[model samples]
Target: MTSLADTPKAPGALRYTLLINAAPQSSQASKSALRFAESLLQMGHNIERLFFYGDGVLNASSLTVMPQDEINIPAAWHALIEANGLSSVVCVSSAIRRGIVDTAEAQRHELYATSCFTSSEIGGLGQLIEALSNSDRMLSFG
Candidate 1:
């Protein structure tokens, strides 16, 4: 059977930025995207960033509660980004709308800690622009 690891690259392989717009379990979007990212890395390409927009912001939640038998998707993403030192950015506007505050935002709002962990940071749309400018390819797993 073909695997994501077998995906081909042309000459002058490109740098990629993955924009995940779906929740981890909302579909296979995030999971499949992440696995593809891993396969890209295995193939010796660079993922410039992983930008979580829309409902995808939930992947970085530190307070995510999943059943013991279920896969801990957040932790998996956290480990992957950390191990690769990849930039994982969550959309600030979307995150705030979904109650995914950062440490500073939490302190500012006088609320307890939010779901988003330290592995990902809350950033503006400017980061997305920058990622596009820097990356040769933009993959959308929305």
Candidate 2:
């Protein structure tokens, strides 16, 4: 197996912004995005931000419980984000509409609890625009 240290870093490592647009259980988008992010990091490329839009915001839900036989996509994402100290953003509009909320959001909306993972924050399109401006590439998976 090729280890991360064995993988040659790309010259002039590029910064990337990843956009995920599908729900974790509904499709391969989340898995694909995760794999790509791992590859980028292993190759010494910088991920500026992980932007979850549309159904992709589901990936940031802490309440998601996958079957024992299946992989826990959200947990995997959480681990990756934590390990790499990556910036993860779930679109506030999409997240709220889908019932995913951080603590502040939960209080703001007068909900009983927060369901969003701690590693991700509910943000707006402005974050996406800023990420795009700072990164060399923006890739979308769905």
Candidate 3:
């Protein structure tokens, strides 16, 4: 008899994509999603991308201000991406509307280039579609 842990993964590998549609402050969705992804990676799974959309684009904003007592969700994501080399992509339409601007977008829009954190990449819906297509699973948090 083979133990569950000893048995090979039925698909050999598992890849995941994550979509977050909630702001870090008003909801726990962003934090919860990150925690789950971290645990999955520790369990030897692969994370293809973390796509922040809707209000979740705030997670990529460099201008996010929080009280001293609160946990820094964006900082946590930055550390995780830096440490794990994970891909962090924010939806371009959502980000622009939410003031999460990268250098190029800021310049194009003639605004101050100071909103987006370095760990975040501004992308399109196509990125999410690609991730969903390639990954074994796509989990959403709102």
lDDT of all predictions: 0.85, 0.91, 0.82
lDDT of 1 at 28: 89
What clash pairs does model 2 have? none
TM-score, candidate number 3: 0.88
- Rank order (by lDDT, best first): 2, 1, 3
Query: TM-scores across all candidates?
Result: 0.88, 0.92, 0.88
In candidate 2 the C-alpha lDDT for residue 111 amounts to: 98
Q: Candidate 3 lDDT (Cα, whole model)?
A: 0.82
Q: Least lDDT summed over 10 consecutive residues: which range in candidate 3?
A: 1-10
What is the Cα-based TM-score of model 2?
0.92
Q: Which structure among the candidates has the greatest TM-score?
A: 2
| Model 2, global lDDT | 0.91
Report the C-alpha lDDT of model 2 over 34-129, residue by residue, as the tens digit.
899888889888889999999999999899998899999899888888887889999999999999999899999999989999999999999999
